[model samples]
Target chain A: MKNSFVELHARERALSLLDAKTAREIVGPLDNMISPHLEPQNIVPESDDGIVLMRGMINGNNVLVVSIEGKFQGGGIGEVSGAKIVAALEKVLEENKQGNTIYPIIVLDTGGVRLQEANYGLLSISEIQNVVIALKKYVPVIGLVPGRVGSFGGMSITASILSYLIATNKARIALNGPEVIEQEAGVREFDSSDKDLIWDTLGTKQRSKTGLVDEVVDDTVDSIKDAIVNEIKTKKDAHRTENVDFYLSLLNKLDLSKKLDIDSYNKLYQSVVATKHEVPAATAGNKEGTKSRGRLWFEKLTGIENATSSISTVLHAQKDGKEYIAIVPDSDNKFPRVREGEVGLQEGFAVASIVNKIVADDKDKTVKRPIVLVVDVPSQAYGYQEELIGIHVALGSSAAAYAKARQAGHPVIDFIPGDAVSGGFLAHGLQSNRMIALDDDSITIQAMSKASAARITQRTIAELEEATKHVPAMAYDVDNYEKLGALYKLVKGIGSWEATDENVVKIKQLINEAITSLDGDTTLHFRYQTPIAKASGRKATLAVRKLVDEEWSK
Target chain B: MEKLHFNFDTKDAISKPVHVGVVASGDLEVIFRPTDKETEVNIVTGSDGFKEVWGNVLQRFFDRYPIQADIEINDFGSTPGVVNLRLTQALEELKDEK
Candidate 1:
């Protein structure tokens, strides 16, 4: 039998099972709401519309359901379809205002924008993301992935961007599908064949184990329904302490990737698989150590087109008698060599000192400047010698610097003038309160190529490409990284160094406006979209806010 | 391909499907009911020469849990611990009247 929510509308909306008639209401074209993409593709349009918008009562509470069918033009979304989803989300938010919180359940199944429709689908996707983000404010977005057409493309990325994701053992999530990797990186990288291996790589189990997916269940309606009901019942319960420590402990263990090999990866997998660690509980109310007292303001200054050829530069303070400084701390594990005689200190000490300087410089000033995190590291230093020297601490020190800047009423605004990859990117680029990439010129997150991932997965690139035709995440590029919410913006350019007198003037104006709305003490506003505090802390109230909002509005 | 029809009426066999308690490691469970209609049995496995071995095992278990039902089994190297538990649990769940 088809699952209640995933199957066709007629089956899902049947009034027989539900207590109220809301569940079975006809939507879409059945209600005359067909997508514009279907007409062009010459596909027989689904009567209820491509976007399944089901409104009904589930277990005594009102709920909203939004789903996309992969079979229909690969479920590529267009304006009308996107608008319907946003409308449903907006309605949920309105309901929250009225005290009848709605839940938003997105049964994701798509390959992304309808390539045939071109930019229409792409623009629609942006709007959809905005809607989802807004809906996240009032209610939680429960991402559900199932069926033969695993979530990928924009839909999959959206799922990843959501606060809580529920995936079946059958589901898979990724940005670039496998075929794109094969095309760009060549066949040596990813072999899409060997179904078992591919499934293992992108399966829900792998994602859940990695903490990307919140839950994994059997492919059945009852299993899913039961889980949802469980959340609803305990939505007001306190959070567990274990979740808080999990992130810190996981960060401590992140080195598994630094010395990555098949053997080491397998060992890590075995350790996780062999034991189910009891996640610690979080304290009720705002815990002392976790609260932030001030807001961090960030802005951008576009660099020159070709003359300076830099997006944003991290300038060093003066050294000796000169106003210019050089040689910070040794960062590279192997070549702990600082840029000798250079105006800036060594990379290691520079990151630490920059935080100190930025915070101190802005302390007495009425309006604080966003710490400009000048990033331009090609790759993390790699060598056997470096491994023994504890690179994690070096990276941690850099993280500490960003954390300090964030706590001191300063936002870490990272400008990627060049390449950012792996741990290097996480240490600098990702640490920013918000990261904005330079339009198409910057190479953001997603290091190596499909070939690299394929090599790691042990599949021939051609085979992987062929397989990716069905598996969507492998078909990706730098542009696809934007869909993952990693790159907050693709700006034209932040302004030039020569125009700095004017640039600083404009930058200060923008900074002043941002700071005006902030509470002087709070360093940051936990992006409300995050359910980590609720899930790990097991804070029932926090959990309810998301649950109620999702049910009523989304 | 061979065709086989199966129907067993065991004294203690249950007639409904109900709660789900275990789907974790080392255990599998489901329920079955004799809808008193057309039902069939088919078992194919990669493990060599286990047809009669499986048939006899199913026949004995069906008698013990005698409930009329159609049974289908797909094996992926399951252990003996799993086989008995799955059969019993499935029977109990089928007996549960939702």
Candidate 2:
């Protein structure tokens, strides 16, 4: 018999997946409540705002299934729909805390944030991320990424951090949508019409190969049900420690210089795994006594002997007669996953604590010392333990602390000498008032790695390179990043990766210039005012903001 | 967006409140609450040009049921078929509840 569940809508999918006659929807359509914002935009709002929240039984176990209706606004999340999802998750968290084992199953068909609502969507996603991390402590949050409108944007980050992700063969999951990437990076980087490329990059099978997806099943409801059942029964609570060494070694072995297909990526993964078994155990702990480029720069910039403290990855220093905090990778870190400069739980908390402490110390003072971030992070450490310990909050806390520090009249500047990628960049440098980077080929900045991006967009490195020439957002080099108007200044004439005396002089001069230029200005509104941001099609964003403001005023 | 309200004379009174359908795209929901007097209907729809069609469909629904109740509908471009189906389902559910 042909299965009818494959063609079901999102609400139907939720009801079908639950135990027969057990699903009771809360805040459902009959409530006659709809989005207030949609009416202003001349859009008819759905009563439930495109989300179905049902308290039901799945395989006789109490569960909450939150399904997004992709047909409505491409399953974009606005205030009401976002609130429903958050409230449902919050309810689950509350029940779980009361010792009631309420499992959460999020059926993600969203295209991420709703651009019409803009800031509200952004805020809601952030709140959702915070709650998702909190919920994981009680039960494994299962994510079902079926096709139609596969999860993108902030939802992709949320999906990646889930305890167990089950995706259909047709499902596409990625941090950046192909169309957005194409718009930002150019057609050569990501052709929106290239179905094969999009699928190969973000399809369930590809994500499975990359270890981002836990299980890939057929599109049928039975298959999905069985996968979720199996996960609930057999999956262990996710912890980063389990996969730290593996990821660290795998990331170490990855050759980003070459165009990597799934086959090549898997080969590299296997080689790393094989070599891991052959390597001496002693070398794993030998990260001590070895100074990273960040540490070397910290020492040179500070010009103080033995100035570095014994903190995990956070380096405290005095530069140009001013105290600054620098978070760098501790290659010999006890947390193996973050040892290679990826921000993990410890690094996140450390950065937050150091910054928070600095803010607290200078609370009464009018002139807060400048905080310099020596950034070279590849990405947030991706593993089970990181998620288990709530890496989102850890990274979020650090970001919040920097924002706090900047608001408190401190000049926060980011000096990038290495890879500044993904959430690591967001947590460390993106919040700074002014950012300076060495104009070196070695310095790269973008969201996530190229291999992952190439997979998500189904393009080769050559295509990405070609697109980078036209689309500054697609480019990882500092020169292109400078074109985005995100960076305050880019210093040239740095001879090597190491901080030489002359290089330090140039950097310090630029740092002072950056600080002076800030003139106690803390808001990041300056980014929109940049000529590059205005010229490079940020007009749409500005226009939307203006429209939203106009609507709000009335 | 449009809002319409109508009150029609009916013979029977609904005993309790009942709800049906979903407010997905091209769909709607109806909630019926017990009323001792005239049957009242309230509609809020996304479609701007469908006031006359909505009136006709709702009038037909009240004609078929003839029940005294307060009816509320929140629609998102739902068609005549869906509107009738939801009204029928809501009335049927109300009868079952009684």
Using TM-score, give the best candidate's number: 2
**Top candidate by DockQ:** 2
lDDT of 2 by residue, A1-554 (tens): 25644367777889888998888877766554466556554455665678888888888888989999877777877656766776677778878898988889999888776644433354355446656666777899898888767777556656755788888776787655666556534576567799887787677777777566778778888888988888778765544212434554554465545444656665665566622211110111223434555656766777644343445466665545566555566666666557777776656656766776778889998789888887777767654334322354456556666766776788888878777776677567767767778788877676646665555444576765665555445566778667656667777777336587887888888888988998768766465567875775244334433432332213
Error of 1 at A158 (Å): 3.4
CA deviation > 4 Å runs, candidate 2: A20-22, A30-33, A237-262, A269-554, B4-7, B15-19, B35-38, B95-98
For candidate 2, the docking band is acceptable
TM-score of each: 0.45, 0.59
Model 1 C-alpha lDDT per residue in residues A1-554, reported as the tens digit of each score: 65644454222422322445557332333233444333332223333335666777668866777767555445665545554565566666677767777776777777655443322343345445545545555666666676556675445535644556777776666544555434443444444564665465566766665555677777667777766666555442111111322332332343633434434544454454222222111112221211100000111222211111010112332211111111111222223221211111123323444555556667786655555444444434332212222232333334445555555556455544344443344345444544444444434333334455455434577755554343222333344444333333444444222224554455444433434434453322232223432343212223323333444422
Model 2 chain A lowest lDDT segment of ten = A277-286
Native A-B contact fraction in model 2: 0.47
Report the error of model 1 at residue A212, Å.
Answer: 3.5
| Positional deviation of residue A278's Cα in model 2 after best superposition, in angstroms | 22
- What local distance difference test score does each model get? 0.44, 0.67
